[model samples]
Target: MQAKLRMVDAIIEVHDARVPLTGRNAYFEQNLLADTSKPHILVFNKSDLIDKKYRQPVENEMKSKDKKVHSIMWTDFKHKPMVAAADLIDIVKDSVTNMQRYNRDYRTEYNAMVIGIPNVGKSSLINAVRNRVLGKKGKATRVGDRPGVTMAVLNRITVHENPKIFLIDTPGILAPKAENIENAMKLALCQTVLETTLSESLIADYLLYYLNKRQLFEYVTEFQLKSPTDDIYELLFHIAKSRRLINKSDKDCKPNFSAAANFFIACFRSGRLKSDRFMDFDLLNKS
Candidate 1:
């Protein structure tokens, strides 16, 4: 953000709706807050994935603290290009216009930087916005599913009316070094790290605990998963079997239980398990 600030007039921070708090760069948020001169806009993307039950609570939480922050629920791929472009134009126009009206010659031309963490749809958002503005599709450089796909920042140009807008796309953020559980969880969920510091078994246990509390035991029971009698390892083994994650050993031709357990846990963490299990934020605060 600091590097892009030198080139841009304003910053639009895009974050995921399902994990808004987790989908932000701690460094950018802190540094941007300290520099009051750089006008910033908060955009929550992927509202389509949010559960209706939790949406109001999340919105209320954000609004209660920062009332000026703007949010839009982005969905419908067919119309997303137009909607996103219009929204970006509107935001930049309003922000820059006010600065100019106040005789702030320092901030002119409305150069905006699009910033966000990995897999939060930042590239997609930029492409959509550019397509609408240019009356043609503008390609934004993007990497694959792997973490740290964006190793270096790149600039993309968009023409709006008579002026050219420079949009700087930055690398996906890894959590600033922190030890707090909440921060850790946020980093783990947002970044594209292939291997997490937290153990897979621990994550699986947490998922189990969350599901049991939400009365979503049926998900576990659907596969006829057996509850662990006493040992967590045994439970994981059972989970692997239920999920049908088996590997035959080369030597003895035995099922590779360890490999199976890892596969199942990875699927659970990546949301492939179709579990709505999430760490209860409200419950965390109460406790």
Candidate 2:
């Protein structure tokens, strides 16, 4: 990452809107933020997953705490992506226009990099921008639910033509370990880290912890539980039995808790189950 610092004019740091304040890769600060001396826009993608009320608060908190984050905005990649793409362009332009040129002053066109932890809509954002800005029809990068979709540093793809804007997409990378246990759980629960890298049941357990701690009991009814309980096994049993997500499909067979846990985690990550808009802001700061 350090080797390519000279190649771009700005950095677009994408993170999941659900976890706006946590699970940001520490490496970004070391490699990109240090030398770029240019525009750095932190975009919280997947904004549809969280409610709208928390957006300003999240941006404000980040600016107050992390001085490096000069510009912050949110986008939902699933709906009206073109509109989101335009907003992203405006963000980059505003940041770039305001900054004093200490780095690449001779460059006429704009070059930027799309980077963040895994599965945070980096590629999808690129596709949206291409479709919106360039009238292009298809994705330039592969996007998947799991991590490591783009394995290497990719060639620059043209998104805008007037000012000649291009974005380089890179593989998502995380720290060797999280800064703490709570951060680890948040990262795992958000599916930024691979499920195989962490225990699925434990990740689901963390989801439960997050929901219950916030009194976001929507999971109970979503999974057919009569009421909320602290016991993860109880919720898993109900979810498995209700969804019939068991192996050796005999009605009398025991509930497949693992399968149930996996399903629950998927729902959480996909936004089928969501908390208040202020979830991350309230919970992570407390932790």
Candidate 3:
């Protein structure tokens, strides 16, 4: 929040579409709604992963609390950047208009800051924006696909001729020190370092439960998994077999079920499962 206050005219909180609620900062909703200084735009990135059915429900929920929400379904490298940049401009324009109407002095000359957890595509979006505006080819410094790729916040030049806008890219936050349930959910959804922080078993269970609830029981039956077990390794082994994940080492033909299990869990968490496995909010509420 301090960084946002110091650097930019408005704050655009980027979140993954696959796990919108999970990818938010614990204090983000509170801080954003409470703050009267500058307006906020919640940019739901990676919308292509989310099922069409769940999108409206989530958006409706957000709009119910705050009417200023705008959503975009982003996919592919060619279009995502352009869409992101355009959306930022629209959001800034709307905020500026409101501020002026109320006789407030919210700065409009500076570009809006794009903030979010790691691997949320802040840099990629920025680069795409710049490419269109500048007519020159240069990459954004902090862009990367792997986890923990961005170690620190960065400031980059915008495409506008007069430096009218700037992009302040922040490092992806780890689990907050405080044990807030909201924070945990956000980290699980947004933070790129999925394997180290969250247990593989937890992710597996989430997938299993989601698939089962959707009446997609083949996922479990195909793998021939036993009932929920405390053993992470055993659960992973079952998942690997079900997914037909096997190791083909020249030295030993043994299936690398352990490695496959980890990969599967990661993919599921990242929304690469190629199926609509929306989180059962009822279960989450119960937990």
Per-residue lDDT tens digits for candidate 2, residues 1-287, read: 66665777788999998777675776888766865567778989888877787777777677877787767878887787988999998877666656676656787677778889888889999999888888888778898987778799888998877678888899998888987777888777777888787787888888788788888898877876778999999888888888877778766788888899989888876668755533366654563
Q: List the residue pairs that clash in candidate 3.
A: 111-165
| Candidate 2 worst ten-residue window by lDDT | 275-284
**Highest-scoring model, lDDT:** 2
How many residue pairs collide in each prediction? Answer: 0, 0, 1
Compared with the true structure, the alpha-carbon lDDT of candidate 3 equals 0.58
Question: Please, what are the lDDT tens digits per residue for candidate 3 over residues 1-287?
Answer: 46455555566677666556565565654554355455667776666655667666676666665654443334333346676666656556666445532432454466566667678776776677677677668786657766567676665566565536676766665445525543443344334555466654565555555555565544344445554344556666666666666676635555565566567556655555554644435433433
In order, the Cα lDDT scores of the candidates are 0.58, 0.80, 0.58
Candidate 2 residue 141 Cα shift, in angstroms, is: 1.1
**What are the models' TM-scores?**
0.76, 0.90, 0.72
Best by TM-score: 2
Q: Model 2, residue 140: what's the lDDT?
A: 86
Worst ten in a row by lDDT for model 3: 70-79
Which of the two, 1 or 3, has more TM-score? 1
Q: Name the lDDT value of residue 263 in candidate 3.
A: 70
